[model samples]
Target chain A: MSADADTKSVTEVRPGATPAGPPVGARQDSFAARLRRDWPLLVMAMPMLVLVTAFWWVPALGNVIAFQDYNPFSGGILGSPIIGFTNFAQLFGDPQFIRAVVNTLGITAFQLVFYFPVPIALALLLNSVVSGRLRAFIQGVVYLPYFFSWVLVVAIFQQMFGGAGLIAQILRDHGHSGIDWMTNSDTFILLVTAETVWKDAGWGAIVFLAALSTIDQNLYEAAAVDGARRWRRMWHITLPGLRPVIVLLLILRLGDALNVGFEQFMLQRGAVGSKVSEVFDTFVYWSGLRTGDFGYGAAAGLFKGLVGLALILVANRVAHALGERGVYSRS
Target chain B: MSTTKVSGLAPWEEPGSLAGRIGKGGVLALIVLAVLLPLYTIVLTSLSSAGTVNRVGGLVLVPDGITFDAYRQIFSDSVVSRAVLVSTGVTVVGTAVSLGVSVLGAYALSRPGTLFHRPILFCVLLMFVFFPGLIPTYLMVASLGLKDTYWSLILPSAVSAFNVVVLRAFFMNIPRELLDSARIDGAGEFRILWRIVLPLSKAVTAVIGLLYAVGYWNAWFNAMLYIDDTRMWPLALVLRSYVVDSNPLPTATVGVNGFGHVAPPTLAIKMAIVAIAVLPALVIYPFVQRHFTKGVIIGAIKG
Candidate 1:
């Protein structure tokens, strides 16, 4: 399908300039001629290119500071002494950085294990609803929180669960003391995970719901006619139909496992204490901006970026081997 | 795939046993309650009088009495009112600029194998793999002297590579015949884009525009990083400071001798700010929600 589309687009472009004439040699058009013909298009593309170069490409080049003793006051990135692997070595040796790595992995694992299934489950439940209007309303309501900022989500959670919040007031009315849910370090992971589930589970279900809509209804009818119960039909027909999408999403999730989230953790870090709340992104922010250890922070961030890149490449390769269209196709 | 238009319901599908219906209904009810109850409380608390809020300690759950005092107080405060204006200006200007850039670039890139197209497309795709990390982006913004400026929020995120790719895919899907016929009629590329392409692409454009607007409105991290002046903070940043950080509302003044003390409880003020921050999104959400599924599916297929 994609190959056919690509060729069609190519043909479409070809007809724009040389439609009524015999085929000119592919190389016959001079660069200046092509430039004159397509200059308007180039002009349209220029601002985006400039912005991309300035914001993306230039900062990308700034990754070299990971290798330097990058003191901002000491002549910026250029005049900083280039130390080979010294910052990375220090990063690996730092206990705080190690803690951040461990915490990031721990959060990723919890999300994968606990939070990942909520969307699929919600999608399945919604899929069973015979009333489309009701399902749409529920979906809309649930998706609302996904649009809220992390700060707002945290504030809402605090208002509902904090020591002096609604739940606390209710508890006090029952002659019990309020629970310190928001600031409790021991339950930090659970709290954050719950917050994530509340904010994202409905929105995340969208892709799965789309996937479900594509399932052939005939299969379900056939299963039911074969004396299959509803649960049996769901287990056999529904789950199997969803397998490819589930696998695709799972692989993508694994590729993104390192990014447990930055803003969510950042908002709650002060309340929960950094010992429990620190993740890789916050670690970079604190070290780079707050403490002015640019080289070490840059090294840590570079390490993370490389790992993320490597994981995505490996995941895409695995998806190809399994005959799935991963994030991008080779063509 | 089934060629038949299965009527979203199967022939053998039963309404389910009584217990099953009850179970599903219960679960749906619980999910609905979970979402609505919190928002409901926040709005109610924001609208409650200070006496009721103080009586409840935090988050008024029941309506004993209603007042717009909290909203009035927040809107009157220079700090919060200015932040609201800043957020509004940023969201409007930022969305316009981003949509303009994205639409123009997507048009240019939609025709495959144009001059510099391959290299430009490669650069955009490269962004998906490697991040420049926090420090480098910060340094770049700082070096550009955009620090403490609204441009810092808008420019760094002006053209989302993902949005461009989605839009380019959509543009490519436009029947090539239409563009070609327009071209044959003496329409230039820009003219074709403006008259033919854009008019045909309203749904996706609206979707992308809303996406950018929501992003700008919800964005506080950029403001936190770039804008050091409290006076320049956007509504989201102000909401964070007064609500999440537990800072006392600067506008909540207790008059001497309690003669003119009109400030609502700090909790009420905070909830009012939250309500204000979320109000725009809530207002626009229903109009755009239907487009989300279509937009996402298109992007997912191309991506």
Candidate 2:
């Protein structure tokens, strides 16, 4: 069914094969006739156009706020004072902004290095479970946390690790003083990374599990028949089969590397202090909303967006060079 | 494909050495413990009496006494009850609107030779790379007078590009001949979509709807950004402020009518809030877990 659909769609794109082109008047008439025939499809697409225009394109155009003073009460976008490059200059000079960038990079680096392999490891562990029911139960348990809000995750972590938390209480019961794991600035990054893994590692493993299932079972049987041990078969067949997906996910992760998450940091920022917890997103929120520095905050946000765009483009290019399908293909 | 399905082990596939089995069991046990232990503590603590919670000085490992007082207090409080209603309303309305917009768009775009197909798809795909940035989006919402309104929560995120693309891929996978035969029978696009495409694509549609519903339910950041009125806050936002931010629950304002003036134990209250927030997802997740792998794999392959 899918193959037939693919071929039909492919044929729909074939260029006109006639010896002579239709006359200009005929072409115009045909365009109108085609529109008439496909008006329902156009109507179906209209809501999307309206929505994308109002929400996406309009807000995207509001990126111009990065270049303006942007007082909400001072008229609007048009009435806002134009200040070319001033916000950018201020953003670069601000030490807090610099700290946010440094923290974002630092946290993203930690996630890329330490957090990336966790799901693969998890998927492999689950795949080795011969009992299907046990595997399914484990997968369900692990994936449950992914649906939890950061607010709830943070609350759970705090209840476990806060100064007056379960762990602290346990320690104090043993005649030792309580430890302030949640509010300690030095370990904030580690804490957030642990929370992320706890929340998402299992969910992330679903894709890897899917990839693992697609590996030919015959390959494993053949390897076993030829005196290959279980571990050896996994090393030869499983890892190689998962390589493309790993690389694809890695490239996609790089594109989002700068966004090290907003809500998690925002929720926890007060407990850990801004010096250690200020990521790019929280920086924008604090500056724009709390301090009322909309222009500088917008400039910082715009900078992050542009960097993200460039990183995705570069990643896609590199993926194409490696002969792998990236996030999108160039038709 | 069925060759590997023998009930007993194949000749080449012996159960591993005893130590290997033990090691695997230990690791799996540890993983399961890591997930369940925290949850167990939270529930036990929530059920523990206020005296036990206070005496323990934190989360209760063992329930000294079981009581529904904490849950009772939370549901009785107008603030928490109102927040729950707000969250439910937002999730229902938002999911319906999002699915409506996404289904129409996906069906239209799934037709290969549809007018402006390439450009529309390109526009939607562009959303993956270029975010409009926080300050600008806030400015847009505020300027458009959606601030402090539920529309602010529902409109800006009405159509997810990822959902649209995933649904379109699923739609395109339906047999071309089925659609063609329907067309030959003089079925209009709306009729064919309603009578055929939608019915055939229930699994993906349900998966997408669940995703959107979960997203809407769990969403609090948008509320924090756009909502200035405390009365309009969702449960997640209320959870954040009351529990994570360590703010005292508004017991004084909740009035002293039903029970005594004494407030519930803060720890029990906090855990109960977490429980309230997570209960819905836990209820619905098992039914949807099987579909996630299939839906995600489809989206990944199409992408």
By lDDT, the best candidate is 1
**What's the CA error at residue A319 for candidate 1, in Å?**
0.9
**TM-score, each model?**
0.92, 0.93
In the range B68-121, model 1's lDDT, one tens digit per residue, is 998887776677888999999999999999999999999988876466665666
Displacement of residue A220 (Cα, Å) in model 1 is 2.1
**Each candidate: chain B TM-score:** 0.91, 0.92
**Model 1 C-alpha lDDT per residue in residues A28-138, reported as the tens digit of each score:** 467787677678889998888998999999988999999999989978999999998999999999899999999999999998999999999999988887766777898
Clashing pairs in 1: none
Chain A only: give the TM-score of model 1.
Answer: 0.90
Candidate 2 chain B — worst ten consecutive residues by lDDT sum? B1-10
lDDT by residue (A143-183, candidate 2, tens digit) is 98899888888888888888887788889899998888789
Candidate 1 residue B287 Cα shift, in angstroms, is 0.9
Compared with the true structure, all predictions reach lDDT values of 0.83, 0.82
Model 1 earns a TM-score of 0.92
